[model samples]
Target chain A: MKSPLQYRILPLGDHALCIELGEIIDASINQQCIALFHQLKELAIPFIKDIIPAYASVTVVYDVAAIRKEHPSAYGFMKEKLEAMLLRIDTDQPLSHRKIEIPVCYDLSLGIDLQEMSQEKNIAVEEIIRIHTNKTYRVFMIGFLPGFAYMGSVDESIITARRAQPRTTVAAGSVGIAGEQTGIYPLDSPGGWNIIGQTPLKLFDAKRKQPVLLEAGDEIQFVAIDINEFNNYNLG
Target chain B: MSIQVIKQGIADSIQDNGRYGCQHLGINPNGVMDPVAAAAANLLVGNDLNEAVIEMHFPASVFLFKEQSMIAICGADLLAMINDVFVPVNTPIIIEKNCVLQFKKPLSGARAYLAVKGGFELQPWLGSFSTNTKAAAGGFEGRNLKKHDELNFRTVQKYGTALKNKDCEILNWKASVKNFYPASPVIRITRGSEFDWLTEDAKKRLQSDSFIISNQSDRMGYRMKGDALIIQNENQLISTGITKGTIQLLPDGQFIILMADHQTTGGYPKIAHVISADIPALAQMNAGEKIQFKLIEQQEAEDLLFEQQQQLLQLQNAISFPLLKFKQQYAID
Candidate 1:
């Protein structure tokens, strides 16, 4: 048995509705969102187009034309079905997790903001790397770019804000931190996150059997590797 | 029949209805910007509404059809021409072997859609033929159509009727786009989740003011500039799920409406969302164009969408019935 959660259903266009379970990004709230995500998928509502789970919400994107066939109001019917499902859902159980180890190189040459971040925070570069790699982070979401995993709760010591001036182009495999979260750039794109390191491993490969290396609800841990090791990982 | 790209004009790529069910993984649905135009083009050529179509921007690609083929050009009146002759949009036309098709100038709108009969022979990436340029997956080697690129036909051609003209023959019927696209159209929007965060004055400005689409816009999102919207709260929002047509207020006081290739999640305060029915018109609107928003109820938006879908169904029946009869009488297969 689990405590009933207080949530609000917000309208997101005519075809979709977002159920916000909580306001902030918390581990338990995210776990509940993940649990709800699986439940929504299991129901396999034919009208549902996409079920996207973020930090504290799970947005149900539905097909308006299909839902219109059965219900006069598309959002209303989905909301009713979802509310019924929520009554039977149990979020007390621990969320299913898959641990993934990612090797990263914190070399100053590759990590363009490593020295700047260290100087700004008054922490040694090695200490910053140690702080980043010391704990396992929960994958709250995968978004912004394909295969880009948004993981959370970086060590409080190194909690940093997004750069006021975002880089025009951040290289792929760049490890970045913004506020209490951390993530890798799956593709080279315009970004504002403070990059702390780089990884040689391909975060996204369309040709690979499994395109994305990480997914939401994953347990991701960073392992510090020398630049040489990073290069070797790319080769292998 | 396959098309050989003679001129690769801008970043023209292949697109379909859209790629869905992968937003959770951060992959966007990079389909045709103008769904009405694309669907009409596909239907005009006797293909499914969501079949892969060549989405072009002016100066669009000049393609040489390797064999006789029937095709339709829709969306953005780019003044499409077959050799020296003019070709109007929303009409299916049959081109003789080796005839080169080209768009000379932009008469109206922006992106143009060209869909071939029997569809193109291409493997779908994650169940869609839409190109993901950033990810470099799907739609003709996961990239835009380029010079010398040949798109093989998925099925062999077998048209029973013979063409009267040698170069090309224009079909009599045409699909009307009056309901889909209008001149000087007013876009409709619904208040976003963070709509109340806007100051009272700013809220009024959004509906009353006219914004110009910035040059920095693309399929990902449209950056608009006009009245600088001011928010009462200067709070940093946690990243949340975002959908196509979401209008987010930028830190610089401008606005950016997320489009087809929008990220699955965003941290900015969402001020409003463009009603889905108006998206077809929005997609056809080009940079340097003026746009205004009209706030409407959610029920009205849904009603408008349902009506649009109903119209599309009617179009499908109208287009396919004659096509099926023609094929029955003429198809040698």
Candidate 2:
């Protein structure tokens, strides 16, 4: 049997705690973190507000008043409860990730930085798109903006650095790459990622039951589509 | 029944206790910057503590009440007026129909909160009426109130019947303004996860050196210019969930304090987290203001938060009892 991972639970403030599972970003470590997140969610601990699963850790936010109503001390009660729950998590269980396929239009008109990135990598734009779509990526975390999923470990051949000067505003649905990771800008905001393509799907909608289309453990695949198909895809 | 916006001011939006349980989906908890002031305003109007309120900056929004209603204005003295009559903060005032409420200038803090008796009839997104403008979600149409925009109230009928005879009347009891703000605020903080990463000199300077808030500061964060803090080793932290009041040290050695509309996660080294009790004071800080940080124990921070909550509860009970009795009398008759 594989040995269980060691973790540290540190106080973020009076209302939150950070559980660090590992120091490095690895698939196994991420799985462990996600498992703990699911277990905590299942426990349905009162006063727990948000459970955020990231690259290698999970942060639990709670209401101190609600916790204090049940226990003499809020942090003390939470620490003891979480420590007990941590020991019961079964890391061997298979994690079920929702698979999602995103269609992207790689036409030069939409991808403003394609030519620049191509020149830096000494590769054709078509080959870069092919390399990007060929592999399945894991959703490491969802952050920077609402519904902006940070997916990872892109193909080495297409890797490029972030823009020297970030654009004042990156349009929503713009897919971009930075360092070893790739992500989609769910909203129009200032960003530093190198744009490679554009998608027509709405990644985030507050009206929907699930506001964010992607989650931390979901698997994502990018498929190249023609410019005409991209234009026809209904965003509404 | 509704209020129309005559002119929108800088950064005006509807906010409440904030959207919770959704930060995991990368949505920011964009709420009122000053929760204490927001709650006080709500209490004065006989509304729930988490009810949505209009938050405004200097030269705030000018609104016209289409119907008579009871409302309360709290936080920062924006020199508010009703049809040219001076209005005070932290008190419930009944306004006549068609009366225009305007904020002339800023005499004190940077932000002010306005609460209506029945609370604004806004559609809640993700369990909150707070506006998250970046995503164009929540609050009044996911945007700031614009000219000619109408906002309805939930209990307009009750308010109209209660004060039909008065052109304007201020409530007898008012929220105590003494402890609302301090002349020279000293924020309390606790060491963050990466606090040990800083050099001894840098750690010393963090407490001793004074920092000035930069003009670039907004609801997203407050950037401070002070002595550059040096770390023993140049290390990068994995992007993790960051909460409001997290003090992050940038690669250039400067610091940025995350605020109400802060991003869900950040990669910079988190040097400290301002305690919950002091976040309200920090939020009221204006650009070019100087601030100092004082380190406190974790237990001390918790105790301070508990005490503040207790005080708010007492205030709520004191204000709500009379309102409840009046409603009972009206029902009996």
Candidate 3:
């Protein structure tokens, strides 16, 4: 079976390729990305610094010296290598997704924009909670801040616009929903996202070997917790 | 040997080459804005070019030394003094223990670099001594320098009284500190991705109009004010990879010059990138300076960059080889 996602390996200069995945932010697209990532790792073609996978694309940064060493005078070798491997795309197999239970404290004190969102949506505050918590979010990408995962397809009922102006500082782990998107503030930074809840979980810890608790393709379930449970959940 | 700070400036922090490889995670590389000057200062002190040094913005004052060490001030004419005596720019000065080195207000330029011998040693985070202030990652405690912080200088292979004797005043040195600055505040820029989005008149204004460097500027970005760069289509695109010196055109037609500490990715359409060679000049620009961008071909920019890299490599080689030979032949007696 052919894969749902088709990627065009666009050469960026001599040392990089922008893996442009066709539009569609879904599970099938994610599977193709995960498969490609695993395939590159298994091949272990040298000179690659990293494969930075985003929502619908992955950019591979490579060392020029290594590329030249591996494919002497072959200008188009990298592109050819990537194209040849696309035929072997494992479509049948679905990669295992990790379940990350994010304990969120929905305290209005911490959730700075909860009341505003609740009022704007013309829904009860409790209904907002139910709609937000009921769905399992697919971690499409991680960006903007360190370890900040961009998970998506929040219910249309909870669609809310960002504040006209961003807050000067959004504390780390502050959960926010903007329009149809939902994400966590991975670091204490100036942000414009509509913060509705806060997770006490340390989503990003520089001291940790992996640093980021969740990666792309992981499933996230926001479990509403009391202040006691939030305080109990250790922040890295 | 350790160097003690007698007075920390308005903003001073330990910086090296920079922490790379983590930009994808949105970690800003908070290194010396003027990397060229930082490297020069490092070279003046007989340290490896990429070693850590103090990156001082205007209003910096400090006292630090290592083993009766020498230091060089490479960027900004910030009225720097060694024990109340004026220390000339671009030259190495010997400062014994207890001697005070104060950096006065900026006579010209914004940032100044201070490099001590053997480089300042700080615990590195994520394979670099450079600090990421936004992420609070590298350098001393991952923050700006405060009053009375001690910086350690690592030991280096002994090279006696060689570079120190050659030039007493840095102005007389053969280093190409001149011809670096453009005639005016003219910054060369290439066409941005959304250059076409601008109307004919707007595009003409962009090429001709003068934009004042707004005071609403910092490590993150250099905000420019003057001509509102209104676009024909104000579509918000998905944020993507951004780099230092990227001129991002906002919907309002204002420009944000991304600096060293700018976000890794941005959604704004980039107008043009400030050439790598001109980045050092941009780093030293004080607020309220009037600036204009002149379009140059990408090939020309690349060629200029290649030449600059070649020249820097030559300088590195000169200090490493010929100077080492000169020291060996002349200093033995």
Candidate 4:
């Protein structure tokens, strides 16, 4: 129960725990990763404060009092427990998958950078619209901001790097592309991603029962709407 | 009652202890930079620890009613004056209405705190009166006080006896202010989660090196320039909850120390976290001044924090305010 995979858990200062996941950024391994995450959730140690999952690694935070009971140093104790968990990985079982459809408005007024992106890609604006609405993108992780989902494996044709300088403000629900990753802005924050469109749907709402609309391992598809429909979409 | 902001030097805002327990909502706990000084100022004026106080960056002087009322100023010696007469720092003073308070250029330190009795009465948002300028929430209508804005205070009938003898006994009370603030720029820190990820050379530099605070700094985070701390393991980090004093390693190898208005979550590798007790020292640091970190064991850090808490409790008991005693008794009844 303690060991999950060949994960090297290193102690980060006194409060944080870092698990070095080598350097693989494949989306296929998330199934095993999420299953292990569920296992850890079930075991539920008291000292654990929070677990943050990224593309290839997960960092766990814990209290010192609960960590030092069995071991002398928090570093040694966390590493041992994590190494043990890695050894007992149940690879046969798969993680659960969730489907989340997001509503997007491809209007030129709302989608500030779509025309520019279409021009850069040398594709017609309608083709850019069709390709964007066509695929089901998998969420790789959530990072940068609260409820900000990193959904990716975008089409090679649409692959683009971030802007040279980040914009001072990217409106909330802005669907942007940075490198190969496509994500929706959960908050009105400064960002460098190339914005393609905007979603009327709230990616993250503090008032909602579940703040984040999509978690890691969820499948998503963007459905386009006209400007009138986007304007009428209930923000609340 | 509140004094109008005739001259808002550098930056001034109403802050309490801080707005905690809101990280999950992506809101940073915007509060006082030097909580020790803020709490001390509050103590001098017989206010609760969480009472709202004005945090003045550099110098802040105001024009208010000159009537006798308990007020305390702490942090940087901003050559403060009341009606052209010099007012001692750290000591609670009673002044008459129409007295003008002006702060000279800060001789030392970056910020100062002014706490009044009964605390400033302001509407709180999300259960806190703290102003988070980034989110544009809380404090004085969700922003800093402007010219001609007069804030009202919560009325308290119980006045400290020290209020009566403010003129004659001011010098002796000022001595009490020297105990908490030290002259040195050394701040104690606990090793961060990614401390080992740093190269041994970087780790040594961190221990022995002196850092200069950059000018492009704000309440959100302080960008510092020093020896680049290279991370040996260049793995991507997941975004997680970050607290005040969190030292994040940016992509450029620069150190960004999270302060009161830092982001709720971040993905950068946290190299170290300054102990909560030493944050006051960090708050006092001036831009371009040399600062160094003193490494301490986690246990020692925790112990120092507990000791500081004890000292605060002791200070609270030392006040001979009869009304405070009566109020405590009243609460019990």
Candidate 5:
């Protein structure tokens, strides 16, 4: 109701407001959230600290001290500005979507659970790789860890449940599957997802111009690569 | 010259003001738990607010100073003792070379900040000196301090000339920050966006209930052991950005207050938010400690933060004059 733009701005603590575009995790709602994210970036509100685009929401973390100088209530000032921006933001406007190709080596050594997965699913390891590589997945959001992208809608036939006992340390670049969801570990941290393969491309590099390889809304498809190719990656 | 670490604490890591604007990429700004105490420590030693300081947990580290420098210990009142002389918390002290500074007991507080005059000689990662242990980057090899690890000082110069031949000398002026952090503090909170998601009875129970800080807690978040808050409707919450003091209602009905190293986004129903002004007090609270949340207006929360900031700035101004005189008298500047 704060912004007549079909968006519900929820108060997140004292410094942030979550602009809910929709309740369900729909693609169009997410797109509007992402579009609004880019628009807010272009607007470059000085008081805005971060514009975080989730599945169907954009939570804006603003500077309370800075905003208070301009208006009486920090939330009121930000809510009004967000409403004004949302009114003009074109969510349906053709948004730029990047379709990235990632190469993965589905070796048993790298993918610790591949052998067990193949045996349990009654499918050959090669066929399992084929099913994984054939489809493109949309990155719903980047969360849990730095550069860790949460992608969705895994093939129903190949959907796997997360391991009951999570590994204490999951290596970075390890591709894993959690029922209806697929993601890559961007850092060496504890994880529970069933490992299927390992990617040659770095999902996150802090030194690079763009730290995270994949962003929310990007379409990504896995490509089968040999161990030699995986080892030889980035040699050039 | 570097100060040699004699005994290592549980998780003595380097921290500063923290990294910001990188949460969208999923990187959390894991900095000092107590910003107010950390700032006071830095200001006492005449260092900038962003300068790297050692965040020491109870059973803290024993540092053998290889260089004579002015230092201040703040936050958790770990019994800071040097050469058998008790170095008081929130007071700047001049220590001579070879003096071993150790925390004897956890008198109060959970984490202590050790800030030197010119700060630690450390490199920043992603524009912050705060050690992100999860990523294994930044702050002294991207990990906590270990025994025999030598930490170098940024401004390597002759210091503590006023100490004149003493092992350790407590400076004249000290910070009065006890008012900000009291024993069994009633942390203030403001209504969250999803506050109405709870039943009217649950809403009243929120204020009436007193929660205990669970052992399963860290810099990321504090899990509270309290009454289960039943949601009025079982509505699925979409993941959205959460902040430092967000109080989210978990599936089992317990609350988890997001902290310094919290995730960029979460899907749990946020019931309330610990006001920014009281976060430092909450940060000092450890396991087994009781916490009571008092609901207040958002406007009042903002005013409290403003008041805290003004008080901190006032302390900085008060310390500067005596520090300048200390430097002048000691001929260390």
Candidate 6:
């Protein structure tokens, strides 16, 4: 069994608390964060608004007034309750992974930065796509923009830094890579990531019950599709 | 029961208390920049605190009320007028049908919240009426109010018949807006998790230096131009959850404060967070305005927030007192 994880809990302000699992981004450390997130969520603590699991930390946002109504001091009460909950976290518990397959068109036209990346890494464009599609990525966090899932740990050989100057506008459904991380832009936004492919699926739909397509602790696999298949793909 | 947009000013959009419990989905809470003013406006019009209100920037919108309605303009003093008569803010005003309401050049503050009785007729996306323009979802077809865009009132008919008048009628009482204004340009901040990551000189500069809000500032964030705050160590902060009022240290050594429409998470090192009580004052700041930071303890920050909330409660009670007395005396529902 893995050793118990140690974490430091810090206040984000009066309203939220951040549980720092570790400083580094390791899969095991992230899994521990995911586990704590689930545990706290399953506890269904009153006044808790949201629990966000990131690469190395989990932020718990709560209603201060609501918490104060139950306990005389909101911060004290939250700290005490959270400290107790932290002890009960089963770090070794296996997380149930929700595997999702994303279809991508890696055509030269669609992959705007593929040629640039190939030149920089001294790797063939086709080989870059092969390595990217082969690995199963983990959702480190969903943030920056609505439904934008930050997933990661791409092959080190294909890893690249963010663009020196960010593009003014990155189209929605544009799949990009930055450093060791890869993610898809859920909305049309100005981004600095090196674009490698495009996805036809709507990653975020406000009308849907679950707006974001990917959640933390989920597994993602990219499936390569030809330009024709990408164009013909129904975006329902 | 509807108001047609005669002239859409700079970036006016419908907003409520914002979408909660959705930050995990990477959604920013795109609400009114000044919550205190929005709540006060709603309260003045006898509406719920979270009722949808129109948020307008300087040189605000010119609207034509199609039907009799009650409205409360709060936040910035935009010199609002109805039919060329000055309409006082922070007080409820009953407007007659076909009245042309216009907001002239801003007298003070940066944003003005216009709240109508019974709120606006808009569908809530992800449990909020806030318009997320980037996602193209929620509020008035997911975009800023444009010329000729009409919005219907949810409860204007009831209020119209109850307070019918040939001309615009102003309420006898008004909420005190003096408290919302910053006494000084200094804003109280609590040290963030990465506060120690900064150099000693950087930490000192944060307190000593006065920063001017850049023109690039918006609902997303307020980029401040000031002394370059250098970090002693070169550390790459992992992406993490962030909230409104978060002061993040950019790579260039300047600071940017996350606002109402800030991204849910960020990768920059968060150096400090503006206290909740001072958020309204911070929101009122216009471009080129200079501001300083005063560090406060966590307990003090909590106390300030509690005190602000208490003040709002007292204001609500004071507002309800006269209304309750009037209702009892007139025996009107």
Best first by DockQ, ranked: 1, 2, 6, 5, 3, 4
Cα deviation of A122, candidate 5, in Å: 5.6
Compared with the true structure, all predictions reach lDDT values of 0.88, 0.87, 0.72, 0.72, 0.87, 0.87
lDDT per residue for candidate 6 within B38-137, as digits (tens), equals 9899888778888999999977789999988778999989999999789988898888889999987789888899999888888888788999998788
Error of 4 at B247 (Å): 2.2
* Model 1 TM-score (2 dp): 0.97
Between candidates 1 and 3, the one scoring higher on TM-score is 1
How much of the real interface does each model capture, measured as fnat? 0.83, 0.62, 0.16, 0.14, 0.77, 0.64
DockQ of each: 0.84, 0.75, 0.31, 0.23, 0.73, 0.73
Runs of candidate 6 with Cα error greater than 4 angstroms are: A1-3, A70-72, B158-166, B325-332
Candidate 5 per-residue lDDT over residues A160-227, each given as its tens digit = 99999999999999999987789999988899998988997888876676777888889999898888
Error of 2 at B167 (Å): 2.6
Model 3, B43-100: lDDT tens digits are 7656787888888887785765544555778888788876657877776665655557
Candidate 4 per-residue lDDT, tens place, B82-161, comes to 76678878787666555577787787777888877777778886667888665556787767767776777677333345
Q: List the residue pairs that clash in candidate 1.
A: B160-B330
**Candidate 4: regions farther than 4 A off:** A1-101, A119-123, A135-157, A186-188, A200-221, A231-236, B61-68, B156-182, B231-234, B320-333
Per-residue lDDT over A28-89 for candidate 2, one digit per residue giving the tens place of the 0 to 100 score: 88888888888889889878899998999999988987676566677787888888888777
TM-score of every model versus the real structure: 0.97, 0.96, 0.86, 0.78, 0.94, 0.96
The sequence of per-residue lDDT tens digits that candidate 1 reaches over residues B1-333 is 688999887989999988899888888888988889999999898888999999988889999989888899999899988977898999998888788999999998889999998899999999999999989999999888889999998877744355665578887667888887656668999989889999999999999999999999999899999979999997778888898899999988999998888888888998999988899999888899899899999999999889998888888888877677666666634
lDDT of 2 by residue, B94-138 (tens): 898898999988988888999988898878898899999987888
Q: Local error of candidate 6 at B165, Å?
A: 4.8
Instruction: Give the per-residue Cα lDDT of candidate 6 at B280.
Output: 90
For candidate 2, the TM-score is 0.96
- If you superpose only chain B onto the true chain B, what TM-score does each candidate give? 0.97, 0.95, 0.90, 0.90, 0.97, 0.95
- Which of the two, 3 or 5, has more TM-score? 5
What DockQ does model 1 achieve?
Answer: 0.84
